[model samples]
Target: MLSRAARPALRAGAAASSRAAAPAATFATLREIEGRLKSIRNIEKITKTMKIVASTKLNRAQRAMTESRSYGETSNKVYQSAETKPLEGEGKKKLVVVCSSDKGLCGGVHSGLARFIRRRAATEGDNFDLVILGEKAKAQLSRTHAKNIVLNFSGVGKDVPTFTEAQSIVDQIVQLQGDYSEVEILYNKFINATSYEPTIIEGFSEEAFANSPNFAAFEVEEGVLPNLREYTLANSLYWALAEGHACEISARRNAMDNASKNAGEMISKYQILFNRTRQAVITGELVEIITGATASADM
Candidate 1:
């Protein structure tokens, strides 16, 4: 099989085959890179869209939060003016209402509330019953403090919260009628566009409010106290929901913004690698062509 002249021709054919296979392999890699690039581009688009939506919602959420604050503040004055405090020395427990949302994608918005509760549980030694206002916190707190949950509500925090929603929640809370000394509404407080913290608003029981040291100054009727308590509960819940919504929107916008930035960085990096790889493939093809032409001329 080794006649000298035929051997050279066979070697040339084999070399051409090898060169063709190399280009095929390089093309396969190029296609893979292209697929990855497309996927990343799609993700970037989605994140950017989410950021825009959150930005739009942030303004409305802030407005709702601002409006609700007045209601809570005005209602709280009744207790503050009378110097009200939670009942003590009765072996009583407090009820904690955790205001979280059904939705996620905000940075630690739900987890922040959960963490706060866990910390309180650790320090307070489970002397409180939890009334979860959203599915998100319920799922989390249920794991460790499941026994402490007396009542939990769902289908909340989808949009800017309404007073009707707050009233409904307050109604359920009032109906619970547990032996709680006081109630606490917990929510994420909006510190700024980029910062938030867990905060609580204290709520006094009817007995506690009535027994205030300065209670005699107001001349309030016993019949009005029940209504006042319910109204105050509603007001506090509305405030918590609104402020938590604002915090969530702001955090989500920031999260999406960061995601988009990271995706852009990845896209830029991949683009450079793709361009270099493509140039390499072209150079390889040109080399193969030049080699073939030179071999033919030699023949």
Candidate 2:
């Protein structure tokens, strides 16, 4: 039972098993780290590409926004000169049009609009009906104000809006069944490259426009006032869409840039971990070999 041959064989077998277990566990950990590093690097690439695309689109969106702003102002001059204001006429409810985009990955661009609506409901009371423009707002509002939604449009905010799209939206709105006293358009106003705020544009009903105290002062233009309603609504809608698109692009670019930076940080951290783990593995193997040789020599 105490034979030298059996003792040496037992010692070598025990050493082999212990050494094998250590390397297996260490190698498994190494593989896991490598997999994580690869995934993070891929994510970084995606975010950087997204940032670049958004940057490219931002310029065109801003240009369209500028032109639409001037166009909207010119169209509103008649009403502005006439001092037209929205009236709370005869117990009729007001309507709100929330302008938002269908896509996400831009920070709070859609949620901000939804938050503004909720804040208004909390302070002003939920008397107005909603007409949401984008799927994002529709989903967000449908949770709380499902009953208040009167109309909604999808597939919007994919690109810079055209006048025809605005006209089509207005046509559907005009056909909706409800004699709203006033209509208000809510959208994100682009303030700067990195800032946006929720703003409202007043949309008056025909009766309110005609009944304004200063409406009589405007020079009597034949047949112009009759078509002005649709024209003004479309112009304002197009302006809102353009500016909102610019804000979305700017926000997306910023969001993607931040994501890419975060990914870079993670990659750096994991790379360091990988290097340290590899070094430890090598050292462990050398230690096992040296210990085995010394043990064999003693035997």
Candidate 3:
């Protein structure tokens, strides 16, 4: 029922629509694949850089932690021995020093430490106070344990945590002991480059100070024990800092490695899709070209 002229126009319209749809479909496919590739590439770069930075920091942190462990062990032994002779002080309250990292992007290092603190608090009742190191810890603990937090220290990084910094924190803890009964440290201990374990260390109140068998070996002059006590506090803080740093580096390294691997897989999948889309576009063009040549030759 259609006129000849109208039939040609309709066929032409259909051809145009088909041609347009072909390229649009191909273009859309290519664009989607390309976008994913770009995103994956960006993620890859970030993860690679993070891995390198973590590796560098890991070495230094490990060395510092290793060097400090001897001091930590010796101090613990000394403290155990010193528990024999009772000294003068008053009251019994418990203080906890929790160490974490200032920054995130590592996995659950901060959350794990916070969980440990929460569990301990639940078990220990409401009598304990907290001295938190790191912004991450503050943020994590603020939700539920904010009231127990007595102080927060932030901005500790890859640089060797200074003796002065440790001393100041220790001084604050000692001051708190005058009001409280006891002091304890909760932190991640560096077991290896890949592993860190949370641990708790306890310090005695002034009244509970005693001379034990280990203390019996070293005869100290008057006023020396007080100086040694300060040293012990500082040393413990230093060890905690080193161990926390090591744990941060380890977590970061693992996170980055996983990110990089995922990025690589995404890039591969996108590359395959892009190649298939381009091939489809080429095939469509070749079919149109061959059909046109046959018509021209017949004419």
Best candidate according to lDDT: 1
Question: Relative to the true structure, how large is the alpha-carbon lDDT of every model?
Answer: 0.93, 0.90, 0.77
In model 1, where do residues sit more than 4 Å from their true spots? Answer: none
Give all TM-scores, in the order shown.
Answer: 0.94, 0.95, 0.85
Candidate 2 residue-wise lDDT, 1-299, digit = tens: 77987888897899899898989999999999999999999999999999999999999999999989986777678678878887766668888999997999999999999999999999989989999999999999999999999999999998889999999999888777888887888999999999999999877888878877788787545466646777888898899999999999999999999999999999999999999999999999999889989988988
Q: Model 1, 61-129: lDDT tens per residue?
A: 999999999999898998999999999966799999999989988999999999999998788688989
Candidate that beats the other on TM-score, 1 or 2, i.e. the better one: 2
Estimate candidate 3's alpha-carbon lDDT, on a 0 to 1 scale: 0.77
**Candidate 3 residues 1-299, lDDT tens each?**
99875776676668767887878878887888888899889989999999998898878878888888876677777677665333335444577888886788888888888999878778866666888988898998999888888887877654766667788878776665336555677888777767777887766554445344455566765467667777876788787877777888899999999989989998998898899888888998899778656645744
Clashing pairs in 1: none
| Candidate rank order under TM-score | 2, 1, 3
Worst 10 residues of 3 by lDDT: 84-93
Candidate 3 to truth, TM: 0.85
**Measured by TM-score, how close is model 2 to the native structure?**
0.95
